[model samples]
Target chain A: MSFPYSEKVMEYFSHPKNVGEIEDADAVATEGSPACGDMVKLYLKINPETKSIEDIKFKSYGCASNIATASIITELSKNKTIEEAKKLTWKKASETLGGLPPAKVHCAVLAVDALRTAIENYEHKMGLLKEKKSTDTNIIEKRLKRVINPLTGLEVLKVNFVKKIDLDDGIITITVNLDSDHPFANNIREEIVERLEPLWDIKKVYVIFNDENERH
Target chain B: MEKRNVYLDNNATTRTDERVVEHMNHYHLNDYAVASSQFSHTPGIKAKDGIEKARQIIAEKISALNNEIVFTSGSAESNNLALKGIALANRAAKRNRIVVSKIEHFSVLDSAKRLGKEGYDIAFVDVDGEGFIDIDHLKNLVNDETLLVSIIHGNHEIGTVQDLHSISEIVHKKGAYFHTDATYSFLQIPVDVKKYGIDLMTVSSDKIHGPKGVGALYVSEDVIIEKITDGGFQEFNLRGGTENVSGIAGFGKACEIFSEEDVERIKYLRNDLYEQFKSGLKGVQLNGSSDFSRRIPNNLNLSFDYIEGESVVLHLDMRGISVITGSACFSRALQASHILLAMGFSHERAHGSIRFSPSKYTLKEDIDYTVHHVKEVVTKLRKLSPLVEQQ
Candidate 1:
């Protein structure tokens, strides 16, 4: 009867809030190490003019402590201004959840990292714009990085976020960086292709990962 | 809170059987005495008799001579005695190597590691995915310089039983003594010291519903073991401590509870439940052997993909069913099951492993309830899992 979790942590785990992806989020970030077997993808729809978190959601693949921390983070950060959300610490998030077990504090740390990352992405995107002008090819890399390949746990830069970054007159060709014997090599390629294919008016978005000839 | 309790964690420990309890209570109430003071008083004489009778019962169970059994604290201590005691006792010019299998319990592994630092060369033989030792590889490792080869009789995580008959033979052929930690597999399967030709073995009392503090190490006549602890002239001067009179009495009583028919009944129920879980759930893979004859009767280790094993354990606990996981997060070091990893399981699959062990007292309805709960828990957890649908 003495579970290590608080009632609040268990509640959030059993019935997580704001789950799943936001198909076209203004900012997105993934946190946690796949090697540790805990990962979180935080997708946020921001109020552009107000610079506030509007709608928030999460997709977490981890233990109960991890999922609960992710769910609680979304609940505590939604509708907050960027400054306020970034100020939130892992300690505060754990206290808000009534407290996690001593061994599970890393889960809270991951939640805060994801939130801070999302806001930073928003700020970076906002910096490039007067407002809402994301038709740039470089913006494509940021968006594709949002798709956290479960295995590598790396985003755009580590896993072929644009291996060469070539931009022709209209064609924007990008290659995915994948491991040779990766089990989800196909899904990673498809996700990158699916995300970039709908951006701007690019004539073509070619998908490639772990290209053998290029892998010297 | 009002729901019925379901305890299927017999491999970890079990409720002390009522018969064992009665013997323990009797000895605790009346027979408590200094067994070494047998020349002094009546209580001392009675205590000495109780210790001897208990020793005789354990000796008969394993078909070993009464003098060959040295009672220690538990299987962990017995392993220490068998490995280190033998090593220190036989610390000679030539014999200075140790070999243990990868799938041995932590006690055997840790003890062998301790010997390694003291100048003994240590090597581990690999196991197949099902946890069977690679026999040819083992044969190649053991040489005349090899001091002792210790392996588990049955893996506590995967329930894969190592064939002591062949393993002991290999060690003996190389002139190295063999020790098997039979803590988990002792009474659950058929064990005979002579039939397997084991030079040494460790058996636990608590594992068979006896008292926890009493365990015995079966050291053959030829193996000279040095004292791990010293003081008194007890346990043939090898283990120097006063006997745990009540626990030893209970240990002997627990030894008489097992029969071939009882083991068959346990196997039938374990196999039946394994079938139910496999048939009822998707991606529900049994970790060890499916063939009933190859593994222990009351043990089943299974893994469900796309989720962590700790969550399943918590979910089952919430429903009043007790279980354990082999995942590293659940382990002492927060490391995943070395057994599963050594058997070639991916880290993800290793974290997803669960061990279900039921004693002879487990009812059919208890098994059914556990299975139904496991299916429900796995489905619910999958819905919360991020990796299940992504890949």
Candidate 2:
């Protein structure tokens, strides 16, 4: 049977680059969860003087697309300034690998998330990050944009599943336009909670379904 | 020489036997008339004879009467027919409940779900860790109001073989018709429908090295089942369609060509492959029954720790070995195998599960090659896995 992978994806997956831990790393961050069947941990050793990434490595516990995406993202960010690496997008990483399957585009997102989080960690350590305000709707929406609908391979917000977002007394309630019985409903909800729960000021995160489409 | 391709996914589908193919060529080329035309022309008579001969062979294999076998497209249709047909026929008989195991093929499970949507009380019986149906739970669920209790004889993924005799006994005691999807166990294990007290059995030819698109459902003569498909009278009026004469002939030829010796040899290879993995790898767990006799002879499912199964599957594919994984990443639904999850495995365990099913055509060299490449792939992936601790 034919595999649903591009030749570049297979090439990187079969022989992935930067597949290890950076033992005395400047910054490290992990994204995704084992329960979701995809996780990537990125390690960066940045040059403090020039603010450039001296070396970058990654370890993945996921499928070929996850490994391939992580490999491509590390290749794209090595030796670049931390600011430049932070500017790298998941779409660019996936495009460099000749584009992933629609179902696997989320792996690219996870890779980019891990890389940016590691850069953020480095910035926080160097006191380069600004004093952040308390969590707000815009920050919640920015994080929610990372939550992908598995069926559509796009952000839940972009797919118009986020019907409403309400933040009150540190409690975030997001209403999605899907029934609980939809095949990917639980996945979307779990991802939303996973994304919003880690905010510094968030107290509780609740995801409610609109039950508007229960065809599944 | 080019690297040899080793296929260990026989549980998915087998390579059709050459002898069966040669036998089918005659019906496809010469006697290409529909069996319904038996009263019309000479070729039609030959086609009818060919189909009847196939029916007789399949019936004899399961120790059923020739008239009891109804041909369907394959096991999925057979399962759909058995569940929906019995539910429809017994709609007015005061039995509105259907009980099935949680680990049944989607054909059985989804059909029962459809029946539930139509107002039938559907109950899913649980399975133990080894994928065996819980006997006491089944007994509790299947009562007088239950029209059918459908379970799989041999689980397709994990390879656990259920005790049909005791299951049938329980269902019969409750006055419920017992149906089994024996697609994986039809030829691999001996099944006597009469001895097991099975009312309906679904068997597919493709799993037994026969041509695809042909399967038979054995319905006991006393069971009442309505036709789900409406068409011209065919398959004893229980199923309506033009017969697949060539595929049926090929299926019969496959059954005739099946030898017990091949099963014994494939079992040996399967066991040897597992033994090699146990000796060569660390943190490898067997997912199915520990008892060899209770599992499908040609099936072995293993979960390698730390590393995900899809990576191993792709790496093995690069080395020309074919296998399947239960990882959510590998499925379009983005969910792990329901069978493994229903067995109470963690998502990590389910993501690491791999199924290797060797057929009679698999060789010792193939097993050795697979084990070696699998070890290399697992070791490499484990090093790159965030779940694995750095030493």
Index of the highest-lDDT prediction: 2
Cα deviation at B43, candidate 1, in Å, is 1.4
Model 2 TM-score, 2 decimals:
0.87
lDDT on C-alpha atoms for all candidate structures = 0.80, 0.88
In model 1, the clashing pairs are A160-A177, B328-B335, B328-B336
- Note the B-chain TM-score for every model: 0.97, 0.99
- Candidate 2 segments exceeding 4 Å error: A132-216
User: Model 2 over residues A1-216: C-alpha lDDT tens digits?
Assistant: 566999999999988998898889988777776657788888899999999998999999899999999999999999999889989999999889988899999999999988887787676557686785677888888877655554333556787868888899978888887777754466556557756765656667888887642212
- lDDT, candidate 2, at B8: 94
Please state the CAPRI-style docking class of candidate 1.
Answer: acceptable
TM-score for chain A of every candidate model? Answer: 0.68, 0.63
True contacts kept of 2: 0.71
Over the stretch B1-391, how does candidate 2's per-residue lDDT look in tens digits?
A: 2477999999999999999998999998998888855467888899989999999999999999999999999999999999999988988889889999999999999999999999999999998999988888988898889889999999999999999999999999989999999999888899999998999999999999999999989999999899998996898899888899999989999999999999999999999999999999999999978898999998999999887888888888888999999988888798899999889887778889999999989999999889888998999998988767668
* CAPRI tier for the interface of model 2: acceptable
Model 1: per-residue lDDT, tens digit, B1-391? 2355789898888788899999888889897887855567898889888888889988998889999998899999999999999888887658888999998888899999998888889989999878999999999999889989999998887888989999999999989999999998987776899889998999999888888888999999978889898988888998877888888888888887756777887888888888898789988788876566878777999988777888788878878899988765576577777888888876667778888988878888888889888998898877766555543
